[model samples]
Target chain A: MSAFYSVLKRELRSYFASPLAYIILVVFQVISARFFFLYLQGFLQFQLDPSYQLQTGDLNLNNLVILPYFGTISIVLLLIVPLITMRLIADEKKNYTAELLFTSPIHIRTIVLGKFAAALILLIMMLLLSSVNVFVLMVHGNPDLGAVLSGYTGLFLLGASFLSIGIFASSLTDNQLIAAVISFGVLLVLWLVGALSDAESSILGYLSVINHYEDFGKGIVDLKDVVYYVSLIFLGLFLTYSALESERWR
Target chain B: MVYVHNLTKRYGNLTAVENLSFQLERGDVLGFLGPNGAGKTTTMRIITGYMPPTKGTVHIEGVDIFDEPLQAKRVIGYLPENPPLYNDMTVMEYLSFVADIKKVGRKEKKSRIFYVMERCGIAEVRRRIIGHLSKGYRQRVGIAQALVNNPSVLILDEPTIGLDPRQIIEIRELIKSLSGDRTVILSTHILPEVTMICSKVIIINHGKIVLEESLQKLSEDMRSAESILLRTRQNGEGVVEKIHALGNVSSVKPGAAGEYIIVPRKGAEVREELSRLAVENDWGLLELRPVTNTLEEVFLKVISSEGN
Candidate 1:
């Protein structure tokens, strides 16, 4: 546990030591804020429109602004989370610092979990900063607090899943750029799978990462969706462990 | 404190280390000498638990490294050919991180980090970023990182490979000071480094140990192979035949500039006889001195002899 903490602390410090973390945070905030305003303007126009009054039940704030806002951020996270996790293990391998960690009295699991946690923490920070858009609704307008909280939870799960696979990709290579590309490619396919499958009950559709996240955006935290994300997190970390262990033999 | 037996590491068709075996007692400084790509680094990596061998086992303090790697690794500190360092971290931060992973007790962590920093001569630059430091200082930080846990078995591979003369001397001195009651394995191809710092020497070539002997015994063996150089101003014909005919001389070979290198038979005193023969043959001997073999010749002889 101490070993895990040390690696986690070092990884977090490394993220902040460069301009990369600040740049990522600033960019995410700008993009998410822009999407929020676009959705808000569209929501207000629909509420004032006479033809839209017949669909008023379906034109609530959750559908008009919050759900779409969280949806855009989820896709944005697909691009950004890779940037956060690309260097976690790849940088260590490139600089040969992996040798130090490999020779130390620590399990491979500890190293993998430490890096995963650090990236998760940074993603959560990004989510909190963007929550200012929801906070604005809370102060000036009446927004459903439960739905807002559940939307945030959905975004966290989606981002966390991306991070785990990012770490797995990072473990496959020493080049950070290649790591980033590999994770982005994997995530793009997974996201496209939701559209590729026509039925929600199909295997491909059920396996889609974004498919499970849809329920959470509707303010529903199903046990099934939680299990899916947790399973993905475990699979990614397990593959990373296997990759690292195989390297020692080579 | 460390025992390696029948270790072999094969990467597909290529074998890096083959049937290698050796042991180290407490406080023994074993110098691992080899040419480039001679598997010195591979052996050190295996010993430090960074990798496993394809065959055989390494026991550190009676713990099998393959079976209980963490237990074995807890007693080892390794500095590979390239010092593994986080370029962006401060010297203090790097050491603290290493100490933590090495499982240094909380109460001793601060003192141990300070002690290693001071011991490795990096105390002045503890807060400095490792990437901004010079190669010498970075190497010092690498050593300090290894020393943070006060490991019982410290393995250094080419520690002074790229340092300037002064820095090399300082690192050698630092390593010498740190050798008290600790088992150290210093690997390098430089012969003087072995003579200066190692109590026992092991020379490896082509993934096999060519020679392993105590420094004292090696020097003694070098001294016992007596050879004399006889350089003359006047080139005398038939001098080689005359020397071969001389009962005390075993073999005589022509050296550079008309000099003859004469090897004497065991327990023979041929210097007096050779001087008398020189006068009788009217060869103006300009120089006559015993040829002492340096470690270089011994190493070359061992390597070349193994080739044949």
Candidate 2:
């Protein structure tokens, strides 16, 4: 566990030592805050329309505002999380620090887990920052507490799954641009599988990460979706560990 | 307390280290001499447990590197050909990170990092970023990282390969100071480096061990086969003919400008007799000095003959 913490501390320090972390944080804040304001404006405009109000029984602020806000955060993560994770293993190989880590007494799992945790921490921070919208809604109106809690859980799972995939992509190459491209390509395919599939009950939907995230957006927590994301996290980390172990041969 | 037996690493059909085996007792500084692409790095990597060999085993104090890599690695500190340093980190941060991963105790981490930095002569630049530091400082940081853990075995590959002369001397002195209970194995093709600090020398060629001998024994062997130059002012075959006919001289041949290089037979001191003969023949001998073999000659003789 000390070995794991050592790597994690080093990795997090490395992230903040460069300007990448600040740039990522600033960009996430701007995009998520803009989406939050736009969603609230659309919600207020709907309430002002008497025809729409007479047709619908009621308006749930959780569904109208908080739910879509989480949706936008996930999309934003898909685009920028690759940028954060591109340098995880790839930079170590490029800079030759992999030699130092490999020669140490620590296991490869500790190294991978440390990097994964670093990326996850940043993602969590961004998620936490975006949750300011929830505070705003609580001060002004009633939002379902259960739905908000489960929605945050789902977003956390989604972010973790993205990070693992990003880390796996980074392990495949030393070029950060190539790593980013690979992660983006893999993520795009997974996200679009929701539209590419023919039926809701098909395997494509089961495989699409964005499809599993839809339940949490609606404040509905399902066991299958949680299992899917957890399995993906395991699979991605397993592949990364295997890739690092086999790189010594080449 | 290090042993390697028949260690072989093959990348596809090409072999990097082929059946290489050697041993190092505690406090023995071994000079690993080899030409380029001769598998010095590959062998060191295998011994450090950074990578496994294709076949064979390495034992660090009786613990197999492949079977129990963590325990084995804890006792061995390796500095690869290129120092593995993070450019973004300060020297202090990098060393502390290494000390942490090397499992230096919580209380001793600060003192250990400071000690290695001081020992490696990088204390002045502890807060400087590694990327901005010059090559010499970077190399020192690499050595400092290896020393932070206080490992029993040290493997340094070309530790002074690119340093200026003063830096090289400082590093060599540092390495010499490090050779008490800790066994040090450093690789270099430079013969003087081997002669200066190494108690024993292992010359390698074509990914195979060619010669492994103690410095004492090697120096003794160098004294047996000797050559001397005899330059005379009077130019004639008389000088060569008379020197060749002498009993102690093995062979005498004409050299440029009335000079002849005479090879004395093994264990023969023909310098005085040659001088007497030169006076009798009226051959004014200008230069007659023993050309003792340097480490260059010994290294050349070892590699050139064994290359086949």
- Let me know the DockQ for model 1: 0.74
Off by over 4 Å in 1: A52-55, B232-258, B267-288
Best-performing candidate as measured by lDDT: 1
Model 1 residue B298 lDDT? 87
| Residue-level lDDT tens digits of model 1 in B1-308 | 88999999999999999999999998899999878888999999999988889998899888998899998899888898789999889999989999999999999999999998888889999999999999988888888888888889999988998888998999999888888888999998778988899899998888999999999998887777869999998567899999888888888989777699999987688999899889888888888998878889988988899889
Error (Å) of candidate 2 at residue B172 is 0.9
For model 1, how does the per-residue alpha-carbon lDDT over A35-136 read when each residue is reduced to its tens digit? 999999998887788988688466788888999999999989999988998999999899988889999999999999999999999999999999999999
Clashes of each: 0, 0
Q: Give the DockQ (2 decimals) of all models.
A: 0.74, 0.74
Tens digit per residue, CA lDDT, model 2, A211-233: 89888877789999999999999
Worst 10 residues of 1 chain B by lDDT: B218-227
